[model samples]
Target: MNIKQYLDSTYLKTAQQANLTEMENTKVVQHFIQEAIDEDFKLIMIRPDHVKLANDMILKHKSKVLIGTVIDFPNGNSDLEPKLQQAQTAINDHADELDFVINYEAFKNGEITLIKTEIIACAKLALSNKKNIKFIIEVAALSNHQIIQICALIKNTIIANFKEENFANIFVKSSTGFYTTINNLPNGATLETIILMLENSNPLPVKAAGGVRNIDDALTMIQLGVKRIGTSVAKTIADGHVSNENY
Candidate 1:
């Protein structure tokens, strides 16, 4: 596909949620969201705290927008209950979709059942209000074999959630930027891996995140079959094409 066509497609702008604690940080996020809205980017992924800010910005600018937020975030050690509560709170705050991390330890320990149960519980919590939930499997931490296993767990959990609640809008994500090993997301290989996983399992959508920094990287992933691209670099890419911006 052409670079511009891919650039014009759906990708996500991620504002580190923990940074929302400060006024300046929030303002920067708001500014980026506005720019993305003006450019008509596909989606904007912000921290839970920025939901109201993002929603207000979209309304003020008269732009139609889709909102996404993460649950359990960079680390997967948090108990499932709190993660479930966080997902519930995100939905209440008007997030259109949710992304969350799976319990890595459970999968690493070969406790497949526990992993399935945990994801199902969290997915259930998000769907309790009939919200769309996507699971972040932290692909950066998983070995090739573990990646497939994790995907299997996610597939089963998604099926289970659907059978019980029938609200299965699950997505498999690549990485949470919080972890050092994947502080940067591998573009080509990661996209290929995700495609392989999808081909082997049910056709759930996949989100490619972590180190996406430019238009080329974003386009490459999209061409490779990634339905979503997550990054903090949207402003950088947009700025490269526009003039007279306050830096």
Candidate 2:
């Protein structure tokens, strides 16, 4: 299986999070971007701050690797304005894809309108810019029912407001790869959750982010109908090796 095509080789940690100096952290991002270019992975998912760096490298090499950056990151609780602002910046930096963390917390709090509005506004921005967009639902923080509901919500919202051709550009992604779960539970896409997402999202597409560790995991997700897999261990998986990293 040509697993590299389905992988969004990810590195989203900040300097502080990675316990590295700013320069050191940037070096890591640079190395990842170069590796993605060399390995010909589908995309490189990085923090918003590094989109320009990735874009510059891709341009220099005239590579086909796409650039993806996260908006509102691990926490999707931010107000819509902040998310829009962040996404705009990423687009300005020439990011090919924008993955926005949806306000899942509002959905959990019975704020349906808030969640719907955010989806519509942010999605329109990305689509208008001709950029691919993914809504990270953070499945690890939700129940199975919520997962299905949110997936349907995202699917329905896009279908209702956007053209049919635009549907392919939007995706209902599974997680941010940064959520923390109790009792060491899986903090990302599990088989069960991917099934839920696939069954509900339909033509909207699904991206199985987080917890996908190896070739078998990547293959399983693709077989289950996930169009993309966001993982930090893209190289190991591409090499057919199991990754020991939890994410």
Candidate 3:
């Protein structure tokens, strides 16, 4: 596995605070972000409030630093209007991509039409800025069968929408940090989910996240067809042995 490609393809997230006085904590977070980018990370995801700081770093480094902002992050409990507002705000702040969580309960409740409508609305919001959208499925919450069904359903629906909208990519993502069970696995079901999605998707990219802590793990997920990794452990992974390795 090529380490540089994996590093460059990842979307690293940092701890973010909502205000300027929280500068110290933001600086600490940015430090790790800088180290990862120095080692060749091309994208970074952060909370909306930290966009200014991240933008500053992106300008300073003269690197291809893509800024991604989460919409209804970790959990997808917000109403459609609020989520759209968040997406618009992130775009207004210059986010290159939007990581939006799908409202799974709506889908499982047989609200497929409604779910599609919501996704379309979000997709349109993102498209208005010529920004890309990655839908987080939170794979740990579903059975394997359910996961496949969701993948097929969304791939058919959302990818078509992206095509009709003339955007290049509509991504399917697995697990947000909200699912702690994945954290317990020796190696997560990240690769497994990506494999399933790839087998089922048309051209949508897959983001395999949650507990991806080292080079081997990241590369393994990538080999299984993941185009992006959402993580905070890039430095540790990029530097260490990545096998029987100590962080």
Candidate 4:
């Protein structure tokens, strides 16, 4: 089933997070970009700081792999200006997709206006720049009801503010693959949560990220209608082997 095209091979860890020096971390990013090009994966999801690096490598090889970067990262608590600025920089650096971590805490706090404003503004920035946008809801930290509501909120906001033709460029991604849960629970995409996201965010596509470790998991997400799978083991899955690597 040509799974490589459905994968957004991801690496978003920082130097401190990975216990590596800055130069060492950048080498890892470079290797990931090269691997994505060699494997012809659909895209490479990385931190905003590495967007330029990915861009340069892809250009050098004349590869078709797209570049994707996160906007407010694992925590979506930043104000609107910073998020926009980060997204803008990534776009300027040739990122083809911008995955913004939605302000779910605000939603939990009943701050609907704040969340809605960011969604609209970020979506506008991405679409205006002709880049695809994905809103990561960080499912591990949210209840099922919150998952459904946030997905619907993002879908509804995009639909109301943009033309239907642009819907294909927007997505409700599952996670950042960096959330910590109680008792080490699944911090990324799970079948139950993905089902809720798919059903609630219809017509606006879904990218299943986190906890998708092997070929079986990837196939299940695709069968359930996910348009993309974000993982650190894209090559492993593409080669038809189950990876023990934790995303």
Candidate 5:
């Protein structure tokens, strides 16, 4: 398979954390954007703040690589309003895909209704704008049953509220790649988690994020039916280089 086509070349760093001036940070984003266009990756997954930069560069080069941004990234605890507003801003900046972090904390607290309402609203907003969206359930934070339950809920809710056909436009993404695991547990997508996700959210597609650091692992996820792989090391995997970054 052409692994580049399945890769969502990603770079989601904060300005302070990266220790670069805002302008310099954007230059780094542009570098990844440029690389994606050159390597023909499936899309560029970045922070919401850099949507315009990536969009402008894609337009400038007339590249087919799509622009994707995160919503309530790393943590999915924001209220419905902020999530909607953020989604709107990303759409305005021409993001072709939006990856949302579902509030797993709320779900753990037995607030399934709140979680459902929030996801539906965001999904509708993105769908109405003709943009694809994915829900990052943060598998490392949940049990296998929770993963299955949440995946089914997202798939069912979207089908019931929106056009059932549009279910294909959405994905049940595995991890944010920012959540740390306890006792050194896997922090991102794993074979066991992917199996449960595929069993529960089969038609909805899955994006395996984190823990896929090489070509063999990426191809294994693909062979198991993951539609997308979100990583910061897509080029390394394609070039068959060694990268220590887990994500």
Candidate 6:
């Protein structure tokens, strides 16, 4: 397999941490877009504001690298209206895919209906726009049973409301790489969690995100039937280097 084709090289940092200003961040995003083009990776995920910057660069170079953006990132606590607005903005900026953070807190609180509504709304909006959607469940924050339950909820909801063919465009991603832990747990995708997600999310692809640091681990994820790998070190993995930068 061409490992680069399965990699979604990701960088979701905001301006203050990523650079001195938004303009500098655009330059950094442009560099990322060029790297994705050169490496021929499947996608490059960035914050919504830089989606246009990425799209502009990709078009300028006549590259096939897809542009993806994160919505309700790290926290799924945003209300539905704002989330929809943000997603619309990303769409207008030419994002090809959108990864949304699901409201696990609501699910854990027995608010299943609320979680379902939020996901359906976001998924429908993106799917209607011909953009792919991946819901980040933040696997590190839940138990194994919770993981299975959340995935099943999403799977069942999608099949009920959306056409079966649209399943290929939706995913249950492993993590957002930005959740607080009870005892300082590892905050990225784990093998056992990925397996659980893969088994539970039928028909829909599973994206292993967060802590993938090397080619060997990435290959392991692919071997487990994972359709996509999201990481800060995708280039390093494709080039056979071990990545130390933790997303």
What are the lDDT figures for the candidates, one per model? 0.66, 0.93, 0.69, 0.93, 0.91, 0.90
Q: Write the per-residue lDDT of candidate 3 for residues 133-166, one digit (tens) a residue.
A: 8888877777677788888887787756666445
Give the worst 10-residue stretch by lDDT in candidate 3: 9-18
Local accuracy of candidate 4 as per-residue lDDT tens digits, 31-124: 9999999999999999988899999999999999999999998899999999999899898899999999998899999999999899999999
Model 3, residue pairs in steric clash: none
Q: Which residue pairs does candidate 5 place in steric collision?
A: none
Off-target runs (Cα >4 Å) in candidate 5 are none
Off by over 4 Å in 4: none
Write the residue-wise lDDT of candidate 6 on 28-119 in tens digits: 77778888989999999999888888988899889899999999887888888888999999999999999999988888899999999998
Evaluate residue 158 in candidate 4 and report its C-alpha lDDT on the 0 to 100 scale.
Answer: 85
> Model 6 lDDT vs. the true structure?
0.90
Q: Give the per-residue Cα lDDT of candidate 5 at 65.
A: 98
- How well is each residue in 1-247 modelled by candidate 1, as lDDT tens digits? 3332222222222434344446767677776677668777666777787878788888888876577787877677788778878888888888877888788867898887777778778767766666667777776677778878778778766765576335236677777655545444442236556765675446666767655566565666776676666665555544444322111
Give candidate 5's whole-model lDDT: 0.91
TM-score of each: 0.79, 0.98, 0.83, 0.98, 0.96, 0.96
TM-score of candidate 2 to 2 decimals? 0.98
In candidate 2, what are the lDDT values of residues 138-171, reduced to their tens digit?
A: 9999999999999999999889999999999999
Better of 4 and 5 by TM-score: 4
Please tell me which model should have the higher TM-score, number 4 or number 6: 4
